[model samples]
Target chain A: MDRKKNISMAVIKRLPKYHRYLMELLKNDVDRISSKELSEKIGFTASQIRQDLNCFGDFGQQGYGYNVKELYNQISAILGLQKDYNYVIIGAGNLGQALANYTRFDKLGFNLKGIFDANPKLVGIRIRDIEIADIDEMENFLKSNPVDIGMLCVPQTSAQKVCDILVNGGVKGIWNFAPIDLTAPEDVIIENVHLSESLLTLVYLLNEGK
Target chain B: MDRKKNISMAVIKRLPKYHRYLMELLKNDVDRISSKELSEKIGFTASQIRQDLNCFGDFGQQGYGYNVKELYNQISAILGLQKDYNYVIIGAGNLGQALANYTRFDKLGFNLKGIFDANPKLVGIRIRDIEIADIDEMENFLKSNPVDIGMLCVPQTSAQKVCDILVNGGVKGIWNFAPIDLTAPEDVIIENVHLSESLLTLVYLLNEGK
Candidate 1:
C-alpha cells in the first residue's frame, strides 16, 4: 500500500484497460504477447507498455514475449482484484438497480454487498442475496460490518452530502457516477465517472477524425 | 487533432479534467493564475502543466503569471466548448432522465437536446422541455435535427444493438454508460465509461491512504 513505490497513478490506471484487452486475447486462446501486441491492443506504444509493465516486474521475456495468463494474473494482483471487493449502492433507481444486477462485475471480482435508499417502500427490497436497507440505519449497520466501498447513485444535489455520510459511515472508497466533483480530504479519494465528459471526448475525436 | 503530436493520452485525457478545474477557478472569481498555482489546484507538477499547455500556445506571460480569464477562454476554445454542444440521451430511463435534468452541464456548455427510449410507454413523454422519442424514429430525427453526441443508457444486453442503431443513424460519437463495451469502427470514437474502474481506483487510493 506504499503509494510512492508501487507505481505511478498513470501506470496503475492503464493496468485495467490493458487487462480488459488482454482478457479478449486470452478468450481467443492467444497465450503469448509482445509489448507491441499489448500496445496495439490498447492503443498505447510498445515502449510505453514495456515501461508501464517494467514498474512492477519483467512481464515479457526477451524473445518469448509474455505469457498471457501469467500477465493477466499479475495485473489482477496489482489492481487488488485477486480478492473480491464488497460494495454497496446508495441509490435504488434504474441506475442503481442496473448496477446491482450487472453481470459484468462477477468476472471482475466485485461483489454487490447491499443497496441503500432513503425511500421506505424500496427498503426491505431484495436483489440477489442482498436486501435494500433504509438510509437512516446505514451508519449503525456500517459500524458493525463495514464494506470496502460505496457506489454513489444519488442525485446531484445529494451527492456531496451522501459522500460525507459515506465517509463517516466507515466506507473507505467510492464509485461515483453522479457527475459531481467531490472534494474529499487528502486521505479519502473521490474519482468522478462522468458520462457527459466521455461523450464530449468522443465527439472531439470524431470532429478531429473528419 | 494531429495524431503524430507525441501527446501522451494521459495529457489528452486530462484536457476535459483541466477544463473543469479552470471553470472552478472562474466560479470562485480567481481572475489570475500561474503554472505553479494551476499545478497545485489541479494536482499536477508545474512542469507538467507547462508541458501540457505548450502543445497549444503560450498563454502565460514571461515573468508575471497567466491571466486566468484569458487562459480559461483559450483552453475552452481549444477543447471546443466555445459553442454549445447539443447532445441527446438515447435512453429515457431513470439514468437518462436524471442526466437530462443534471445541472453540471451548464458550466461545460452541454445542451441536452432530447431523450429516446425503446419503451412505448416512455415515448412522447417530456422531461425538461425535451420530449422522449421512440427509438424507431431516431434515424429520421437525426437526419432532420442533428446532435453532436449520443449517450447510450440502455440495459447492458441491448447496449451493442443500440450503439449500432446510433452509428447507422449517423452518430459519429458515442458515450456508453452501460457496463458492456460497444463495438464501433476505428474512425468513430467510442469512450467506455467503465463504472467499476473508477471505483477500483478510489478503493486502491483509500487502501493506500490508510
Candidate 2:
C-alpha cells in the first residue's frame, strides 16, 4: 500500500530515522528484525513502530519480524532515495561550496551535478569536479542535464529571484539555505533549511528543562 | 507567566516566521491587526493563531485585536529570545560562513560570537567580525566567551567529537548541521538541523502528489 497522507505528520517525520536504522541492518547483513529489536536500536517504542509500519500495511506476520532488505527498500522508496537525483547547487558561495563538499548528501542519492553563481568572478570555478557557472546559464544547463533538485545557496536578497529562475527552469524542488522564505507554485517544492533556528529551539528546550 | 514546555517548542517554531512577518508589517507600517487579519497575512487560520497564542495565555483583546509592538514582544519573550544570547558557530566551513553572515539570527537576538575551525590555515581568519578560533582552543575560548548557544557547521564525521568537546566546556545546547545522529548527555541539548532530509521529504511529497 502507498503511504497514507492521513498518517500523522509525526509518523512521516520519523520515517527517515527508521530508514537510517534499517540501512544499518542492511550493512550488518541482517536478514530480518523484530519491531522490539528495531525499537531498541533506535530508542523508539515497539508498538509505535508496529503502528507506524502498519500504516503502510503489514510488512511482517504476527509472530515474525520484517525482512530487513525489503523493509529498507520500502522506506527508501517512500523517502524518494531509491533513485538518485541530479542535484545541482545554485550560487556557489560558502554555503553552496560547503554543501557541495558535504559527503553525506551523496550517500542518500543526491548527485552533485554542477554549481551556479550570480557573481561573475565565481563563474567557471571548480569545486569537486563541478564547475560554477553563471546564474544566467542555469536554464540552459538544466535543459541539458535535467537536474531534478537544485540547492539554492543564494543570498536572502536574491532568494526569490533565484528560486523563480530555478522553478521556471523546471527544477522539481529546491533546498533553500537562504534565511528568507520563498513562495513557489504548488508544482514546485521549497524546503527552507535554517540551522540556527533549530539550534535556538534546542536552547529554548534546554532552558525549559526538556 | 513563564511559558510552559509545550508553549516553548510551539512558540519557538513559529518565531522565525512571526519575526519575518513582523518585519514585513514594520516595513509596511501596519499598526493594528486582529487575529483574523494576522492569520490572513501569514496564511494561518484564525483558530490556529488563537490557539497558538492562547497557549501562552490571551495576548489579544477581544475584537480590538493585538497591538503590533505588544504582540511581537510577547512572541519574543515566549520564544526566550527577548534576552540576547551570545551565539558561536563551530566549524568555519561553508555552512559556518553562510551562518556567520546570517543577519536574521542577530535580528532575532542571537549574537554571532565567533566561528571555530581546526584548520591551522583557517585559524585567526575573520568572517563578518566573528574571528575563527582553532578548535584546540575551544575550551578556553568558550570559557572566556560564555556563549549560551552554539551552531555546529562541522562535517558529519566530526559531529560527535565536537559535541563531546563543546559539552565538556559547558556548552549546553547545540544546533547540529552535520548528518550524524549524536548522543549527548541529558543535560546538554542537541538538535539535528538536517537540511537535505527535509528537502528529500518534500521531493517525496511531490512525487507522491501530496
lDDT of each: 0.76, 0.78
Docking outcome class, model 1: acceptable
Cα lDDT tens digits, model 2, B43-138, are: 778888888778777788998988888787776665567687887888887778888887767777778877889889889887886678888888
Q: Candidate 2 — which residues are off by over 4 angstroms?
A: A3-5, A28-31, A61-64, B3-12, B129-131
Give the candidate number with the greatest TM-score: 2
Please give the clash total of every predicted structure, in order: 0, 0
What lDDT score goes with residue B58 in model 1?
71
The C-alpha TM-scores of every prediction are: 0.76, 0.90
Pick the lDDT winner. 2
The parts of candidate 1 lying over 4 Å away from their true place are A1-5, A21-74, A91-98, A117-136, A154-161, A178-189, A206-210, B1-8, B34-37, B60-66, B119-126, B129-131, B155-161, B178-187, B202-210
lDDT of 1 by residue, A49-98 (tens): 88888877767889789999999888777677777877789988767887
lDDT of 2 by residue, A85-179 (tens): 88888878777888899887788877888888989899988999878888888878877788788788787789889888778878878888776
| Model 1 chain A poorest 10 in a row by lDDT | A201-210
